[model samples]
Target: MKPEDNMNIIFVGKRHEASRVLSLNGTVAFVLAVFVAALLIATAWGGYSIAVSQVEAREPSESELVAEWKRKLDEQKEELAVLQQNVQYQVDALTLRLGEIQGRLLRLDALGQRFVESGLVASDEFDFNEPAAVGGPEDSLSADSFAAPDLTRMIDELERKMQDREQQLRLLDQVSSRQKLEDELYLEGRPITWGWLSSPYGYRSDPFTGKRTWHGGVDLAGKEGSDIISVAGGVVSYADERHGYGNLVEVDHGDGLVTRYAHCKTIKVSVGDVIQKGQVLALMGSTGRSTGPHVHFEVIRNGKSENPETYIKRASR
Candidate 1:
């Protein structure tokens, strides 16, 4: 084919003056085609650039990868250490609380023993030497591992319960102590274990002189040589013969109270002897000015003679 490097064109109009002609060159058209082809190649190469960027993004440097793994491992180790420390602290706190609970339980057991020995109660199940008997069915919900906050809450609740129990035990101990003291000091019993109230106190005709006179005590008639015992716990202040009061025994109970036993066959206790209630002080017999085997019992309060009938009547009930 021929090159056809030159081309022409014509335009005609109805009017003779409106005619025109146009022309084109082969070199200009060739240059334009070449420029268009180069632009298409460059656009295709930009896709290759995108592919290269994707390949570079897929491969990371060895140091950068090692640094990333190290950071993650360090974070994990730190978390594990913190968890271990927290667990250890909880264990230590629980151990201390357990010790305190054990001590309080020991004290409670000792107090219970004291009450038992003092005859305050018949028996108790809170024995110190024995472990508590406890058993129950297992529950799936409670079998899970304990969380830190849950364990701490449980320990605190137990501590509060133990403190409350301690307060109650102390109150019980105080009450028991007061009861023991009352049992020891309060006097309420007859002078003789077995006897009869023969002559009342206040007034009577004297057995020796047959004259109406004031009698300071009551006369208890019983078998000869019968035991004459104290009516209350006290210290013996006197135990000797007197002018008209035969072989006499006097006891000084605390709180300005005293007791006297006269006309005894034999004096058993002496001065300074610590005596208990119902302790044998002498033996009843006819001695000095007594007519027969009898004991003259006197209740003295604050160094003055009082009616013995009131004390004797009280002991009967």
Candidate 2:
């Protein structure tokens, strides 16, 4: 190589008396440049390899990613299933409670209807056939939200109260029924609807014979064809013509008590017929030994005649 073609470089360092000179020809410079480029490329390749290793360590594999997603999905599904189960349980409980409440309400309505039928309360005042009148403002202090358990407890308390009320009503009904029965059986009032006492029970002068005779019953004089009602509830034992009394209607009450209404123009009742208090058993007329349109009322206790005035004056139960 020619001396002029070679390039020279000098390096001077402090504290070094000698300087170093390096000379490079065309081939050497080309070879050196190629070698430096190779070193740089090696360094870059090593750095790239390190970076790739770090990325590989940080990121997950495809299979691992799929497995992780599947696990998360399974957990979500389990949580959802649990939530659904809880909701269903609450619904079932609420449904059962509601059904019970409906049944209780129906029973209460029936009981109220009985009260109306028994005449314990006026139908217009307490109408069981219609819904009860109720109105109230929304309570601000009341809970706005209710859980399933809270609702269930409230329903239970309501049912308990309803049961207590039902029992009380039943007791009242029994008492009322007893009172009604007593009232029905009680004997009071005169046999004729419109009448005045004309003859008294005991010894009296007979109109036909003009002789003193024993009178078995009292006579109540009224208009002809007037109503002859029963003084008490009983069953008619005889409702036909008798020897002395005409068209006699004999009612046999319970407890060995009996009553007789005679001298009727028309007999309205028959034997074996049930009679109620104030029921018309016949029509007033002058039949048999009766002087005028009058009813002969007789009260008997164990087949013995008694003064009917005592029973007529007594008040009904």
Candidate 3:
């Protein structure tokens, strides 16, 4: 190599005690440059490898990622199933409630029909067999779906109908009770089922003493042991022997009205016994002051004896 082509390098010690000189030709310099470049490349490559290792430690592996995805899918499926079950339960409960309401409505209809048949209300006015008449102009905003809210509204409407029916039934009951009271209080008909009026009220000749006396009641003669019925519905007040009566039965109707059956062979009712009209009170016989099988029937109003013939002539209710 030529002297000019060779390069000189100098090295100095830290203490400046000694120095060294080196000479490099073109082939050697090229070799040294190549070695330095290879060292730098190796250092850079090592740094890049460390950075990739750190990133891999921070992130999850492929298996872990797949497991996490599977768990999330299972959880979502469970939530969906729970939601579906809840929706089904709600639907079933609403359907059951609707069925119960329908049953109640049917019972109300039956009751209303009975009231109508009993003549409490006019059949034309309250036709329980037919559905209620309802009509309206179709609204543009009408609902198309029978959702929970629509079901709730229908239940509310049914409850309102039930309230209306209950109110009507209460009124009918009141009317029926009043009519029953009137029928029990109004007195009519004869004391005996089969008999003839042998004696009347006012002046009559006494059979035992043959003397003219003011008779207070009428005498109905019948076959012995015939039933002596009550003329009205009342409670029995007396059913024992009296001064001129044997086996007597006295019934007190309401409103200060009463009836008496005397000279009975056998008393069939006791005191305080509530009885209906035409109920047997006793059996007719020749007892007490009676001369034959007869019943002394008398009606009293407000402590005054009334003419029994007037009540007997009234039409039966």
Candidate 4:
């Protein structure tokens, strides 16, 4: 059988009846191919449209990109500004602290200078006008920069040193003052300006009695009315006449030490008068029980008499 060129269809239904004829063979195949091609084209076109929409949704627009960059840049700028402000604040705080430290240093220097001027220490040794001498080996890691914490530690250490120095200076001042007071109270020297040890202490022949007697003090002979001076700084406790010792002046040098001046023609200081070393206390003369033109000087410690010659020799040295 040959392939049919045309085919007939008849349709019968309750509502209607129809009859038609269609070409077959190659045309049918051609139509089916065309349908398949069109279906594929439509499917591919739909898939392509979906893919394009997805891509458009995923990618950022130009304005959005600019806004994002602007937002990031603004955040960075704000952070930088805050960082700068913090640094400035730290710098200001450091500056103020440094100023305070400088003031403390100045005050410390002034205190040191005052100590020097007060003669607490030798000027050349504890010289406050010049920088203190210090030395050290070069550091191998010197390249590292000092941070704020290091600076703070240095300041703290410096302040501690200042405090220690202040305490030391104060102690030195106290010691010096005590030494000066001791020096002032220590008795020494003779009572007359021009005199010789005419009569030595201890057993001696009395000039008037022509008999051996105990002498508590040395006789310093001089011209009549010669100045009789005190040998130590102290308050006068007695300045009056006595039976054996004529016009007398006695000084209390504290710490159980006392000095007595006897055979004076005139008493210059009175009781309660403060007398200094080498100050004139009376005039030498032949007064009660005795010789001429001599001042009898005596030193008493703890109510016991001590030889005045020893002190006079020490004071001369």
- RMSD (Å) per prediction: 12.0, 12.1, 9.4, 10.6
Tens digit of per-residue lDDT, candidate 4, span 1-317: 23334443355666675644454575565666689999999999999999999998897989999999999999999999999999899889888978987887787787677667656667789877788899998888857889988987887888788788778867876776677667777777677789798989999888878799999998888999889988888999999998888888999999999999998999999899988778999988878877687888899999999999889987531
- Per-prediction backbone clash count: 0, 0, 0, 0
Which order, best to worst by lDDT? 2, 3, 4, 1
Score each candidate by Cα lDDT: 0.83, 0.89, 0.87, 0.84
Any idea what lDDT model 3 has?
0.87
Candidate 1 matches the true fold with a TM-score of: 0.52
Instruction: Please state the error at residue 214 of candidate 4 in Å.
Output: 1.8
Select the stronger candidate by TM-score from 1 and 3.
3
Candidate 1 residue pairs in backbone clash: none
Candidate 1 displacement at residue 90 in angstroms: 15
- How much is 41 displaced in model 2, in angstroms? 28
lDDT of 2 by residue, 221-290 (tens): 9899999999999999999999989788999998999999988999998999998889999999989887
Query: Residue 181 lDDT in model 1?
Result: 58
Error of 3 at 309 (Å): 0.6
Count of backbone collisions within predicted model 3:
0
Q: What's model 3's TM-score?
A: 0.63
Window of ten residues with lowest summed lDDT in model 1: 1-10
Clash count, predicted structure 1: 0
